[model samples]
Target: MSGYSGTDCQIPSVPSSFAPGHGEGLEDKGCGNGTWTSVEQLVAVPVRPFTFTEAPQTITAGGQYGVLEYHGSISKPHHPGEAEFYLLRGVLTENEAAQLLATCSQALSEAIGSGKGRDLDVDGRPRFAVEVAELGVLDGKGSALRPLVETVLLPLVRQKYGQTAALSSACFRRFVPEERRFIPPHQEYDSFAVMTIALQESASYTGGFFLQGSGKAFVDRKFLQLGRGDLCIFQYDLCHGVDVQEGSHLELVLHFKDSPQAVADGSCPWYSKMVEVGDPDGLFGHALSLVKKDFPAAKEFVEKACEQDHVEALYTAAEWFWDSPFGLEESQNSSASVELWRRAAELGHCRSRSRLGSLLMQGVPGRLQQDIWEGKRLLRLAFEQDDPDAAFHLGQALLQDGDRDGVTKLLAACAKGHPRACFQVAELYREGQFQFPKDLRQSVRYTKWAAHQGDAQALSNLGHLLINGMGVVKDEAKAVRLFRHAAKLGAAEGMLNYGLALLRGSGGVKVDYQEALEWAQKSAALGHSLAHQQCLGGSFRD
Candidate 1:
């Protein structure tokens, strides 16, 4: 290969001995083979020094090579955000670039093959964003790239971002013309800064450009071009995206977050910090680690983690926000949940897509903006993925829109043993809501299926059907057992029903006023109105 060169960038050439085939044992892994293999032996580290210089004159408008909008601290003053910009110019030895590219490609292929990688399209194309630690195969000596990060990249980051910034995450990103993946503009959080290192030969690809701006509106944007071994560093929260007009693009992205000081030992094998900090997944794991140490509030941890390019965290955090699991305020939770779900959905989390669809279908006056068309599109995407929950929710949404096939979708979910879906099917049979006529047998059957799966309401309702022989053979003893099971699971109505049955000697059980009173009192404590009334009236076995 010819010596590396770039516009306005000077890089030294490597000796011919370091070329692809010049070294012994280097022939084990062939280059450009298009097949990824495990790293059996550690390859010798290339001795190439990377260097760069800042431009003397900065231009404002187009035709300028590089300009910075923000630099110093990454976050906004007083508030919690920051941005920084740096341009690095260097060229890797041909052999080093080839080895690094091969390592990343193999890691990506393995992740995709093992189902750890996210699918961008229904055709099973992999998403550009990949969490390196999530692959589970590459760790410590297991990864050929660990030495590169620890020995080479670590000190560089510390020199640039200062020693206070902790290593947050590293990801492998690949863009192919066939996939035609265009990342929409988005901002990062948790990370103080992000560094992008080019691995592929830039001249080989056409029409791939990187853009970053201060605001979501691309009013003022800076486009950066990086050659092989070149890198760029910028604030994590800066609005950024990639536009691929043609060929393939590949890069390695490393992020840093402002964190408590730790020993900055470059030779200490920094990748091991991933395991020690419980951030092996490198999705929300970094923020989750902070939450574990009480370094940040749970809500803040989730908020920051969700903002990073972690799609799985976006989905899980959306659910957490909607469910108010970590004590987030309700109004904020609902809005944040929907927004996060939308972001995750856009990034192609099928489940998140379905959830956003459900939320959009609601068309709630203020909480979630309505977009029926978009909602249906997302729901269909999820439904095609065989997600039972998505099928159940989409079926309901379609039914509300007067699509009769929604019933079929619900039944499909029920067939998959989705407990809530089974309950929905049972309700449809019980009420004969759509075209189907009322069928007590079908209702009882589906309800039983749900109850067996620990659906609390199903247990109570099915117990009633059993006691009254509403749709099946009467089995008072079994009814009592079901009610008791439900009550223990914190079903308030189940508690009241069990108390009443025991008090009246119903369900073929011997009457026990003491047991009945105790159950009634517990139900009353749980705010069951009927149970409260019975307890207030001191009426057991009345």
Candidate 2:
């Protein structure tokens, strides 16, 4: 075929296969060959068997012209899948590679350094590395090749090998002189394959040998050096890494397999050992890794646990997936947890219903929101089912919505045995906020009840009442005891109040200037503005 000049590269001026004006602007003018004429129509043309030595063929048929460099292909051993690689040539420079590597490495390093990555790990240990693929997406380069690789090349590989295929990348410091030796030695996982191709040549320096797993004896020592257009394919369950002898840089295009069952099975050889040893984070890090690796089967397995007949199993699954510190976008898995809890709730799991209701009420962005009405309804159901926490939440919701009658009913039920409910009832009665009578006597009654149950807030409230003689005779000694009790419960507000009482000698008590100053300072540190100002000499004087 004769090469076409720049002007000749344009579309034909006159339509040759169809009537000149008949198919104008018709999105898909069907040709007799069953092919659509529109540029938007994707027709999967079978790729011709082009070897590495053959002239580079346009994988994207009927498209623009560009330089291409071929990388070798790999055929699946027991499967029919095959993977090939090619470099779409452009003016990519070493500086760009270095900058991208440095930026990605720094970000990963910072993430690991800041405890975020550690928090993401179940055991709170650092990962080998955080591999972020799809850098092209973040860079805004719009690599059309990604889709081509995913849709066409990946499917072709899977079809040829009879196993699934995946594509991913990782940021590493292979180019950094000091960090070159830290490259992964070699490792393998089951029923998986990997193919990596260098996007740019690194003959300028050294190192980066793509070695295959030889045997159990000496895994890390095996090495193979590959050039720009060379492709390295191996089983997923093998150990391998580039032994960078001396290279300025090497940017790779990577393809691998993402096992659906691996998610549920947690069978990744690389991480299974970590899970077995009960690594510091328990199953958390491994589970998160499975999620990150897109092990759909593992995800299904976890989901299945939520669907179990046992309430405990369902609750466990929900909590496990929901609280997983791994920052997998909440929108992705939170809905699954929500659905699980909803199912459990429907099955008369009161605790599950309460949990689901709370999640719904707090609404995660792009997931659910805090629906006060729904939360109240769910909490009411749970309360009817005799769940104390549900009663507390129902009463709280009612109080917030100014539902005086509902709040009174729920709070009364909750206060029957629940100390928290007693405190709430006392607060409502004291403030008369939810249409309750401002009965200081009843407030003191419930506050005393809650205080007996060891509630710090209740004790503090009771102390205030006693000192001010609001519902009882002013008793400085009694108020001091209550304040001290609440302060002992680690209540910051209680500490501040107790300090103030000690300092000013309130309730017919003597004023100790030094003690008052110390307490005021403590309260101020706890964000008590009045106490803070008092410490600064802004006190009530005789």
Candidate 3:
């Protein structure tokens, strides 16, 4: 343990935290007196956990995200109908908000006289931009405002980009009654999305109008009604700013992103100072904290660190070169990558051992020579260390070669919520494939679990089963909604099924022939065979 100058093996290399989307609901309890009693789980909060809900099938304003309307209808010609921002009312209590504002206003008050922090004249006003990181240690305690922002931003980012937003940045802002008293419509390029929270009562400020707009002149405006302790979050692309008049107005501005590359590489001086002190873990962390945002800087830093005999960086670099962003790419023909993994594996990097073992067992042509015995040995070592990837690869290989022990390995991966392994095992149980007896209950369990991760195929499959009353109870309406969601995610089968459901009114939903036809066409374009019949204007059949 002393010799290994890398991450401790006891901790998991991957993030395993997950919370399902649910709203607070009540159920009536039956009483002996033939009456019903209702009870509630009360919540008193600094910030309330937002209730996760999906938009029902309807053509109207604001489905999931808040309404970002173009014309009267939500549908814009260029992009799919999705709002850029939403409102969360009463995230904090007035007292809690006062605590936040007191910090910001106090910092602003200090910045006005003292020659600390960067100086700037925002909109011709004598203002200062003092970062929260500097004031974080004011009372020798930095409130976890960034983590709080991340918790709220995570689900929204996933809904927008189909992935997680892992990092966040924040600052405090104040608007006073003097001067023009507002920043005009402008967007910050430095963030994926921005969370603008009202730290004081709307009654306190006369004209603190938060507006979002687009175009050169910025004419079309959506003036949002953000009250005290309320949050108005919008994407970076949306042009937004606020105006305040006749009173003191304060706000907590926060930024979120899928990657912390910018934050790590000197965007925030506080974080930069922490990572600049030399550690491959920082570089490796940036690589893992990304999915949709294909940042080259993360790859550059991690790969560079690996060349310096950096243990953690080499493990990440191997993953980057070999099969990055969820092991979807195995065709990369870089022998240097394998060698890097080998070096890391020899140095007691557990994940490197897992990855290199999978590759060496199969052997990339002209890149790696097959050595199944050694590969299995390495995988066993990693599996003994409880690496999920090792468990999957080892289990899949063994199962394919007619070994019952492989199922245990696949189940091991499934236990860690590995979606692919879950899908594999689910399909096996459903079809009775690879010596697994057909177990609809087990199949449904795994399929539903994988679908929760927003896998398009898993969603489509689960919908199919739900509609057919296979494994689970019949819920055609719910299944149709799943199809619609999966279709939006570019699943061909989902598109086909959703089109059919819409056309036939299978879900007790309103029939829209035009929309059904459009979905059918999309499915057909994506090579769904069933869609061709409908797209060709033939008789409807599934």
Candidate 4:
């Protein structure tokens, strides 16, 4: 249940020994030389195969050269993982990223098509303008992509790095023109790295050169450009980027970090049981990101959340577990989620109490043991807590138990503002069972209330009352309207009634055979017996 917290910092460069094959010869230019310690010392170690149960943090710090520092703990440390970053202050979430990318790509394409900003680079390539926004998460399309990144990518990085690592907040910004001049030699210093996968192809724009850094000379360096989904990983300290030139701006940044945790023995319980099962691919990182996005106390809880906040925490944990195939046995079928609900119910969490009561009532085959009396008791508890659904259920239970007074009292309480309860009262009245008087006026009132709540069944019932003149004065026009509304809401009986109304032109309504046929067809599709017979020219319709 460990959470994450961090602060952004700016560090001056400290000269350090050049790691081989990390562009050793090139002069350290942009940010001064700094012998930054291993990424392990900087960030909190994580439990391997992490499944984030909460949201991410939102820290605001801006500068050409600065570090966003985060502090958080994982259940176990030795496992490997990867982290994704996004610039929250500038634009929010993936929707914004898609919009910005689409706009910039389109503009760059138009400029190239119009023969503007199409000058050739030093390599005689057409130049195009591009915009680059760094610090963006690749999977911001929605909650759907979180599973993919958390389950698939982080484990892969961990495997390659041999240990878990911390993710940096900085994303890259590279605006490359179609011209060759924009390509610049670069290298990084982190032990392992990965780049964001772009949704669109690079060829759609002009003057985007991805140059691989040559440890050789600074001025005359060799480089290579990349296409979407292509990744480049090397020693942590390689310099890379596009040489500034006119073209569409592109964001190209690499995530850098060192192994954060010490590797554990394969058989350790915490490592094997919790860390492995809990975070199979470090999904917890993404979960943190989501928690940050949705909840207000994301940063605080991520940094210090415990199991006591189990209601929200367990729900998030359940979601993460449900999304991944790894650790299915331990995480997916969590007793924690059920226990959390039970605890909340005990604490008078109305929704949780209602849900627990409903679950008790269901007696899920092979999961929940059957106990109708217990279910009724729970439902009654929830009903007393003012849960509308619980009240409705309690009424049904009491009615079945031959407790007419109890049923009437509970139903009345829910019926005041709850449509389902109102419908239930109408149903009891219509049946004339349990010694309840079949008052047409009361039936119509309750049914009307349910219909107003958009209950299709109630609307159909109201239509029947109006058509038969059972409650209020007969009004075929009103009946037809009710029927049509119910039919639109997918009420099969309503379709049949509306069709019949159209066919007969009853109650001052117009006759339309075509419309009647359509409604009849729909009703038949929904298994309305009379409508089906009518459509098939059987005896029922006549």
True-structure RMSD, every candidate: 22.8, 31.2, 22.3, 26.7
In candidate 1, what residue range of length 10 has the lowest lDDT sum? 1-10
lDDT of 4 at 103: 54
Q: Per-residue lDDT for 12-46 in model 3, tens only?
A: 11112211122211122123332112111111111
Q: Candidates' lDDT values, in order? A: 0.58, 0.48, 0.57, 0.45
lDDT tens readout by residue for model 1, 1-542: 00001011111222344333554322233423322111112121111212224333342312223433223222222113445566555524456657778877787767754535554422222354566532212353226556555555555566666775656657777766323234534445445567787887667654344443322212233345667766677754455555443467887777665543332221112223643554423334455445434523544545655655456567767777676544646524677777788887776666687778877776877567788888888888777644556777787776666555576677656644556677777776666555344678877777877765566667877788878788788898888887888788777777878888888887788889999888888878976777888788878745
lDDT, candidate 4, residue 385?
40
Q: Which prediction has the highest lDDT against the true structure? A: 1
Ranking by lDDT: 1, 3, 2, 4
Q: Which candidate's TM-score is highest?
A: 3
Runs in model 2 deviating more than 4 A are 1-307, 317-340, 362-368, 433-435, 468-475, 488-492, 504-529, 532-537, 540-542
Candidate 4: stretches off by over 4 Å = 1-306, 310-340, 363-371, 505-542
TM-score leaderboard ranking: 3, 1, 4, 2
Model 4 residue 272 distance off true place after TM-score fit, in angstroms = 33
- Badly placed stretches (over 4 Å) of model 3 are 1-304, 319-333, 359-378, 432-437, 488-492, 508-542
Steric clashes per prediction: 5, 35, 0, 69
Candidate closer to the true structure by lDDT (higher is better), 2 or 4: 2
TM-score of each: 0.42, 0.37, 0.44, 0.39
